[model samples]
Target: MMSGGNLSQYLAKSIAVMVFGSNDYINNYLLPSIYSSSYNYSPPDFANLLLNRYARQILALHSVGLRKFVVAGIGPLGCIPNQLATGQAPPGRCVDYVNQMLGTFNEGLRSLVNLLNGNHPGAIFVYGNTYGIFGDILNNPATYGKKILHFLN
Candidate 1:
């Protein structure tokens, strides 16, 4: 058995940084041909499903002494080159429908941070607004300087 000193040291180093869920949308939800997620659950419902699972997983980690978490929200999947290739969006434009759906998921993830922090005293949970950060970079390219590249056919 670990003494309090060793336990505290281990917990201090057990920071968990989780950034994911893009595949759930890009690989599953958007692929109606191969996956039934879109037909089976509405966007909000899907977000709830993911959030519920996320809460359980984080709680499991907390039960094991993980006290710090940095959860990054899903970014703009609509702007992916693969999604752009689908032609559902206009040339050089993102699939707003897909982004909007993921936006619902991101919002829930933000709430999850608050919920976890409120319920677990002394546990630290941070919500990284990657969506907002990425969105700003996409929306105002000039603010960070600009570059354009052409793809070969």
Candidate 2:
């Protein structure tokens, strides 16, 4: 992936940029199931794992020459229309535990970005803090602007 971006500079002379979102499958689905929880149902731990993996990927990308890109980490999955639709039951409210996971993940991402920038000279990794931006919208539906409410139902 890094090499492709590097080489694209000559063909089109345009910087080939790639944005990676959500290391969730590895962190949220696989790690928690295998290491933290037995039934594969815990959401908080899964969220943490997702964040950790994201940090690692960012570091790996910086290690290479693919430093002229941004990484948009996981958004507020709890408020996502899909999760809200699926989680509408007795406790139809958005899951706090899941949100917590997102918080941790964002924190880790911020730290990783700072670390990369501080340590590496020409590192251009931008951490898009989507969680903080969307948290309020999730809490206050009336304040929602032109955002599309994602609904699985």
Candidate 3:
């Protein structure tokens, strides 16, 4: 049970930030040193599994009163410093395979958000182009007001 008030009543006026999906595939499945998620679950089927669960969660949130949502698409996991340090990709490039998976997941997430908006009345979902944003920062930090991408030695 909610403490302050009814969920639907409270959510009716709040903006929810939805950011999820990444670790399971990246750290767990994709990384060679970690658990093998690819062996257990393929991308297409795993995406479906995630969507089904995510939809239930969103609907639950909507049932409580949430009407507006800012859903952040997963960023470029392969381009992160740690991943780069792992030697999977060339020093100056992002891991294409991991990034490809993230892209596919982002596409599915976008579709899911659209589907949720269609099912729930008055719900607004804004898909943040985090992937694009991250890419810009990586390829050209100056565009986002930063001078350059500072790679650590």
C-alpha RMSD of each candidate structure in angstroms: 2.8, 5.4, 2.5
> What tens-digit string does per-residue lDDT give for candidate 3 at 84-147?
7778887678887778877667888888878877777788988888998888788877777757
lDDT of 1 by residue, 1-153 (tens): 999789977987788998768888889989999999999999999888888888888888888788999999999888878788898987767889988998778999998999888999989999999889888878776677665242211
Write down the lDDT of every candidate, Cα atoms only. Answer: 0.85, 0.56, 0.76
Off by over 4 Å in 3: 1-7, 32-34
Which pairs clash in the backbone of model 3?
7-64, 8-64, 8-65, 11-65, 12-65, 29-37
Error of 2 at 117 (Å): 0.4
Residue 54 error for model 2, in Å?
3.1
Model 1, position 125: C-alpha lDDT score = 97
Best by lDDT: 1
Could you tell me the TM-score of candidate 2?
0.60
In angstroms, how far off is 12's CA in candidate 3?
0.7
66: Cα error in model 1, Å: 0.9
Highest TM-score, which number?
A: 1
